[model samples]
Target: MKSALYLFLLLLALQVQGQHGSKLNAQQQEQKSPHSPEDQSQAEGENSPHIKTAPSNYDFAFRFYKHVREEVGNSNIFFSPLSISTAFAMLSLGARSNTLDQLHKGLAFNLTELEEQEIHEGFQRVLQLVNDPHREVQLSMGNALFIDDRLKLLQKFLDDVTNFYYSEAISSNFQNSPEAIKEINNYIETKTHSKIAGLLKSLDPETVMVLVNYIFFKGYWEKPFNNLSTRDDDFFLDAKNSVKVKMMHQSKPFNIHRDEKISCWVVEIPYKGNAVALFVLPDEGTMKQVEDALLKETVSNWMHSFTKRKIHLDLPKFSISGSYDVKSLFEKMGVTDVFSDHADLSGMAENALLKVSKAIHKAMVDVSENGTEAAAATVMEAVPMSAEFPPPPFIRFNRPILMIIVDKVTQSILFIGKIVNPAAEED
Candidate 1:
């Protein structure tokens, strides 16, 4: 008997705050700072999964972003590449032969360099880092499997997913499609704290199983923007099209870098926890050049080249969401067998042939003056600073720009996208 497995990946990053920082320069801060991400990875040794998987994850992020950019054109772009990669990695547990090879290759993992066990362990470590209790950020990620009542999964596969991915399996009556859909959607909504709802519009009655993954993240600014300082400002979409947005203002010493190669200004904003947001504003008409140069090495160089400097910053408050049917995109990346009948997911169950029928990913992010409502109540600590020697440079993000949210501990990019129109919730 042949049965179809549906994969649904939902990611929500709500109430993500913009930059806030003390007045101290970068050099003075460097003396008090801990090891860099690269140093920490090296200290953790080569056996660490965090060290082994970061490059693969980053490569996958860039590849996915390029594809999504091409597909969405000039619309507001946002997505959690980590979320999609995690789901696909989980699915690879049940895959075999070419399907498994394709999954690993699509994820930018080299089988010769990293064994499958090491890759899975790397993801496990990344998940642990993301949910670390010591961090001030609130992040929770989990996976679930909804199995039809009639199907029996392999005990080894079940145990592996539970042990490595921390996934939960629940039996569902898929013969009743509406009930199954409601159950899945409700679970996702609860997991994301109502940030996501009704994720499943419809489900096939023939589906034997559904694999789900969801992530919710909320982080506070170390120095939050004052609500009184935000005002309506113009956000230029182009030379002629402009929209009014509530632009947040701040004048503080921040890590800033100018990339002449791409003709862009890069600003790094720190969160209260182990995360930072990078904003890249391109020269007047050099967005295409910047976009084309979004390689991992370019980002690494920008991070290393930053110098602490005072700047008059003006950034808009925006909320954006994106939903993608990435099955075709995955096929475009050479992961085709899983969605077709050629899929050999025999490792998942006995006496059954399984193939993925659908792959859907949806993500939403909200950037505001003080992050999430829960984080808004916390008071920011006051820090003393030396006087500026020179008048600070003024930087305004009035035009379209690129944004990336990264976790410092694992050096993983949590979310990456661009905002062309702040007013539009969806494009």
Candidate 2:
């Protein structure tokens, strides 16, 4: 399966704090509520036999990441592939023919042999598993559909989003209500724990619908970093440029692998639950080559090649953020139909000719002595927008590095970006 357009239009922000950093965002502290539709049987339809053994498809994600990285160039990049994929998957349920084909191929799904309902069920299963309240991880995902009250949307599409994707739908008169922007922004803030704001500065009067999705995560390292050991150090941005940064130090048994072929080091840092942050540090001046060789199979091989060993590690305690407008990026990915008049979103409404007009994405990541906290939000305006290995013997992340945040259960890449400079400001 291919990755979708705007699949990685991400905003990644990292915040740095000394021994202690800002507490988890407030939205995470609230009581957990089940967002699944009230109809239990409908929501829990027989688990797809395929979902249990099906591949999570990380190849599509890696390919998408490489493309966006090349486009953004030299800047710190971070985004949640799973979040973008989920949003597009929800949108695809209402897609038809060529439009649907583009989405499926772009997202890297081979559902030719699978029933359409089965695909939705697979996503539903994964969503529930990842968001299960019992899990130790704090992952909060919220999706909203803002539609102009004048249009009548199909009940099936609404039901699928709610039951399968756990999204909430809202109605608004974008053409007449000046407050529509504020309302949507408020929802984005609340969903992303206020990490993202102003996703929609203004709404087009002709817009018939807008789709928004946000994901927030906070988790302590299975083995927390010693805040007292954190100290200021030099982080090399290149051969000649460097910046002083607070580096978090830790010594423990960790999963690691060294790929001599690519001249890089891969390490896995486990979050409190099944989630983990995989770091790939290429030998000096080899970031591009390492990235060029990245793939789902390569990553899987590296992950399985890990041998636990006691190694000292120094990682900068820095926060970073990134944002992007990815219409052009999507076009590059061959996802053009949805943005042009040729778009076919007939599944959403009876006679409405709906196509995306704008797509905006924002993300933030904060790694401190305590653990790691990150959040991402994507807004597809209808007015519309479119949207490990280890080793650790004195390994210090003093240079540019690639990072991938993943959920092991689904093997989904929640966030992927390259950090060239810890002190670099958010875009």
Global lDDT of each candidate: 0.84, 0.70
Best prediction by TM-score: 1
Per-residue accuracy of model 1 over 235-255 as CA lDDT, tens digit each:
999999999999988888899
Best by lDDT: 1
Model 2 agreement with the true structure over 219-250: per-residue lDDT tens digits: 66766676566789999999999999998777
* Cα lDDT for residue 405, candidate 2: 83
TM-score of each: 0.90, 0.84
